[model samples]
Target: MTKTFTENDVLKYFYNEVSKLEKEKIEDFLSCNNALTEFYCELLTTEELLEGKLEKPTEKTIQNILDYSNTLCLQN
Candidate 1:
């Protein structure tokens, strides 16, 4: 029987969480489906944009976390 893929399966493929055989199946599935391929492309673009926009927490936030941890340690 032929397999049908869902958006969830595509996400699994995107994250490389699928098995090798499943990855091949999804690649074939995407090749035949324009809409799904477009969706996957959009996901890729979004991931790129998100990666570019990602930032580390500010020093103040880091300090606050350290201070809180110190307080917790003192209480124990």
Candidate 2:
């Protein structure tokens, strides 16, 4: 049976979450479809941009973790 791919499939492909067969299928699909090719490129560019923009835990959060660890360590 022939499987039709969706944008979600493209996302799975982007994240390396798809099987080897699916990956090849999506690669073949993207190469043949201009609109999908553009969309995949956009997804890739957005992923690249988001790499450095992830939010780090706040200082308060870090301190809370440290305090919690200290309490656990003291009890041991």
Candidate 3:
């Protein structure tokens, strides 16, 4: 029989906040449930993005702001 996980179980899984055994259970649920898999995937993506490891803006955009600042320097 398949074990059912609760929302808290899923949340803990997403945050890597659960014990190894619980994580294993979450993995089992994710493997068998499409909705859970998608939820897990989105949660992982959000966590990664929050960790500054995803969707970083381009370096050129940063450089452009610096360049614009240089153009605004006060004339002596």
Candidate 4:
């Protein structure tokens, strides 16, 4: 907690990719600082926003893939 932690460390913690030691240190630091806690919340919200975003293919694209697969199956 005495040493400085960066925003990148916070991002890493949000993604659960931090080491146990680093996560503990970040949590300890965040607990005492209201502003940092708020920022962490923002980071969590941002992460949430970035989740579950799969691109939808057009109908023609889907048809094309199916057609290609059918051809491959016929060849085999």
Best by lDDT: 1
Error of 2 at 31 (Å): 2.2
Q: Better model by TM-score, 2 or 3?
A: 2
Candidate 1 residue 24 Cα shift, in angstroms, is: 0.6
Residue pairs in candidate 1 whose N, alpha carbon or C atoms collide under 3 angstroms: none
- Residue-wise C-alpha lDDT for candidate 4, range 1-76, written one tens digit per residue: 2966777778788889999998998999998878778889998787688777768889999999999999999999
lDDT tens digits, residues 1-76, model 3? 7779876789887778999997887888888888877777888888787887557779999999988888887542
Per-residue lDDT of 41 in model 3:
80
Q: Per-residue lDDT for 11-46 in model 1, tens only?
A: 999999999999999999999998889989999999
Candidate 4 C-alpha error for residue 56, in Å: 3.5
TM-score of each: 0.70, 0.69, 0.56, 0.60
Please identify model 3 stretches exceeding 4 Å from their true place. 53-76
List the candidates ranked by TM-score, beginning with the highest.
Answer: 1, 2, 4, 3
Off by over 4 Å in 2: 1-4
Give a tens-digit lDDT track for model 2, residues 1-76.
Answer: 7667788889889999999988999998888888888889999899899898988889999999999999999999
The whole-model lDDT of each prediction reads 0.95, 0.90, 0.82, 0.86
Alpha-carbon shift of residue 71 in model 2 (angstroms)? 1.9
